[model samples]
Target: MIEKEGFAALVLRLRAEGVTDLDLLTAFEQTPRTQFVPPQFASDAYSSRTIPIDCGSFMEGADLAAKILSKLQVRPGHRVLEIGTGSGFTAAVIGRIAERVLSLERYRTLVTAAQIRMDALGLRNIIIRQMDGSSGLHGEGTFDRILVTAAFSAMPRFYADQLVSGGSMVAPLILEDERCMMVRLTKTGSRFEREDLFPVPYLPLASHIAQHL
Candidate 1:
């Protein structure tokens, strides 16, 4: 398993790549990635790679996570919403930097597992919920920031509507032929602006609706 010093080195590497926020850096340092990683991959926890969780979902790749967090610019007064809680690792990271984190997952099993992991780590500010994240949690009030761990093919309007004015959002956008890009969005008044960034590969964000007869 990787030690604390090794994790620090990873943080430094991220800083070199422009993830210079002290709050985010400290969060990465304090929260052990292994806590949220699957037991089989615990040894490589500190490495900058994607780790798979159960149910066909994968944790956000380290590079992508760093970029999203740094770009979100989560402040102490911010309430952040996470669209995918793969392993709960990113949620914990955001919780340490922001005031509170509310994560939505499409899979109920993953939500339960993530909740258990978060509870074990004593991360109280982050809440994981089982819901269709693509639909957005618009009924739950606005958020100061939003981070999406998976890729969306189209702009999620509900997320934009739920964002507070001046708030920022970072997400991975999927395109055709195994292509994807990191997108940063800012909400101003009733409008939203999108800024497409460097390409990155991330698992697709699933969309679904429930029905009962």
Candidate 2:
């Protein structure tokens, strides 16, 4: 658990950095990064840097997480589909704002670890599953919001296909030239509208759930 004064300072810094979404900030306060990060990186959990996790995965910083989740425009009754449950931190944050969240991760270890943390945090609205997230979760049905954590060489049509009409999605779309940018997509009557957000650096979406990166 983060100390009260220390957590207050972190929240103040987030505000100064222009993380203006009140609900996201509240989620940040509710789920301390320390509780979701590896023990070695606990001290630097609040830093604006990505930290490494097991199986060669990395976890996003609080500000970036806040930005993407805020972009999703989640509502209290919205069901979310998260493509990566790297640290379970993002899913946890979304769980606080959305009605329910189905988070899919490639690595079994990560899935197990995330589930443990979610249980510890008492976040009952989020479900962590070990599955190849690139394919999306058809068995679980569609969702009102979808978030893709990894960058892809092309827009992943599969995920877009899984979104309910009028639903929103935010992901980092990597181009054939290897450049990457965040994109906000909305499903609309058999078609999906795309909006390119700002540029960001993220690893390519894995083709399959590998034992190691």
Candidate 3:
């Protein structure tokens, strides 16, 4: 288990690494990562290393997560759409920063567990659902920001279309050379402006909904 002092130290370390957003930092600091991981991996909660979650998914490391949040620049009034809920730790953190968060997970087991964790933390603004996130909630209205936790071989047009003009999406994109890197796409009048953020190794975003966990 990471002691209180250890967690604080971790936050401080993130701060040193350029995660300077106050609200983003606070959201991460308050949302206990230990609660999102399995009991066997509790000790690795605050480390800068990926950990496994249910349905063969992996939760982003705390440091990388903080960086993603920083790049997101979520405002208090922004509505965020998270493509993969995974353990729901990122959604939980975003729930504290954004006005609302609609997190999509393909597996029912993950949806149930993530919802339970959200409810336990009193995060009423976050809604976790079991759906193929690759499609980007069709009937649902637009979003101010979209965070895709999985890497995409190419930028999905549907996701860019779902964002309101001037809104942005931060996702792991597969480069031409087959290297995966984080990229931010800002929608502007039916067009998107892309910016590269950082390199990352992530599983491809699945398009098919799982029938079984």
Candidate 4:
């Protein structure tokens, strides 16, 4: 858990970095990063660096996570679909803003732990499942917003089909130049608009689900 002073300082730093959204900042303050990381990395919870978690996956730094969520612009009435539940920290934060969050993880261990954290925080609107997100969540109906924590080598067209009209999806994609950059795709009826945000070092999205942790 972050002390009051620590959270205040973190919020101030985020504001300085341009994450001034009031609701987003409140979500960040309410969701403790320490609860989503391993015990050994608890002290590094508030740091601007990724930390290893169970199932060999890594949680993105708090600052980067905040920036991505801010760009996604999740509203209180939007239903969010999160690909990669990681430490459940991101989903918990989204839960504070979105109407509902469905987070998918490939590892069962990660899914179980994420669910426990969400329940402990009294975030019942967030649902976590162990499933391969390579193709996105088809047949699961449409979503108002989608956030993918992993990098995709190419545009995930399948996910685009699952988005509602005018919905937006934020994710990291590998450009032709071999640089992984954060990109956002907004659906406008039958077309999707692309917007490159920033560069990020994110793990590639696994094609297959893990059979074991």
Candidate 5:
């Protein structure tokens, strides 16, 4: 568990970083980041840097996580999909607000670790699967909200197609300059509208191009 002072410090830092949603901030403060991190790095859990997790992946910064979750605009009865379930921390946070959270992780090690963490926290609303996040899960559609924690060169069309009308997606899109930009995409009729939110850096999702020779 994180101390109150440490949690307060995290909240202040996130607020300064432009995470203004009180509900998101409260969720971040309530979740114990330390528990999701490796035991040796527990002390640094509240720090503002990304800490390495299993399978060469790392947990996103607390501020970035808060910002992404804030933009998700989840509600009590919303169905959510989360790509790249790192330590299951983000999924757990979404589970708290959304009616159901379906998260995917490609790495078996990370998937196992995340499941363990979620079970320990007794977060039953999240269903984790070991599958490719870039391609997205099949047979699930009409999600009220979708989130991709990993960076991508372009928005995955599959994800946009799965969103329910009026649903929104928050992801880090890698531009030509190799810089990452946080973008929010909201479904409007048969099309989706995009809004650039902020600049961010995150590990890129393992794409098909990388998987094949």
Candidate 6:
């Protein structure tokens, strides 16, 4: 468990990492990262590194999640979709801000763990689905916001099509060099504009191009 001073330091570090949104920061502060990690790894939960969970999945650190949420411009009453629900911490945070959150995890174990965590936290607005996150949730169109936690070589056209006119998405993108950048995309008319937010390392999306090849 992070002490008050330690949690404050963590928040300060996140702010330095460019998470300046007050509401997002508060959500991060309120959610206990330790509760999302496996019992053995709980001690390292507050660290700014991905903590391994069941089935080789990991819980993204607060900094990465904060950046993604901030860039997505999440707001109350918005419908959000999160690809790769590892620990449900991010989904819980999104649930606090958005009207509804649909989070998918490819690994059944991870999905179960996330669901348990959400239930324990009393997060009622999040729906956890065990499915292929890369292909995305079929039939759930036109989301107010979308956040992909895993790194993808190419943006899914289906995700873009699902975005509401002014909706936004934030994901770790794998570039030509195999490097990853936290990229934010926002829909405008028939196209979406991309912005390079920062660098990040995330578990590769289960449906990555490498898998297809």
What are the root-mean-square deviations of the candidates from the true structure over C-alphas?
2.7, 2.0, 1.2, 1.2, 2.7, 3.3
> Using Cα atoms with residue i matched to residue i, what is each candidate's TM-score against the true structure?
0.90, 0.91, 0.96, 0.96, 0.91, 0.90
User: What does candidate 3's lDDT look like per residue over 1-213, in tens digits?
Assistant: 384665787778887887778788778878988999998988888888899888899988888888888999999999999999999999999999899999999999999999999989999999988888887897789999999988889877667678998999999999899999999999988888999999998998888779989
Candidate 4: worst-modelled 10 consecutive residues by lDDT: 1-10
Clashing residue pairs in candidate 1 (N, C-alpha, C atoms within 3 angstroms): none
lDDT of every model, 2 decimals: 0.79, 0.83, 0.89, 0.89, 0.80, 0.79
The lowest-lDDT stretch of 10 consecutive residues in candidate 1 is 204-213
lDDT, candidate 2, 23-122, per-residue tens: 7777777887887889888877876678999888899875677777778888888899999899899899889999999998999889998999999989
lDDT digits (tens) for residues 67-150 of candidate 6: 677788888899999988877888988888889999987777777778888888898899998777787676976799888988
Q: Which pairs clash inside model 2? A: none
Per-residue lDDT of 77-179 in model 1, one digit per residue for the tens? Answer: 7899998887888888888878889998877777888898788878888888877788678678889998887788877766767888898889888767668
Clash-forming residue pairs, model 5: none
Q: What is candidate 5's lDDT per residue for 2-92, written digit by digit as tens?
A: 5576678877887787767766666676678888888888777777778888767888766667777877878889999988888899998
How do the residues 105-129 of candidate 4 rate in per-residue lDDT, one tens digit apiece?
9999999999889889999999998
- What's the lDDT for residue 117 in model 5? 85
List residue ranges in candidate 1 displaced over 4 A: 176-178, 209-213
5 or 6: which has the higher lDDT? 5
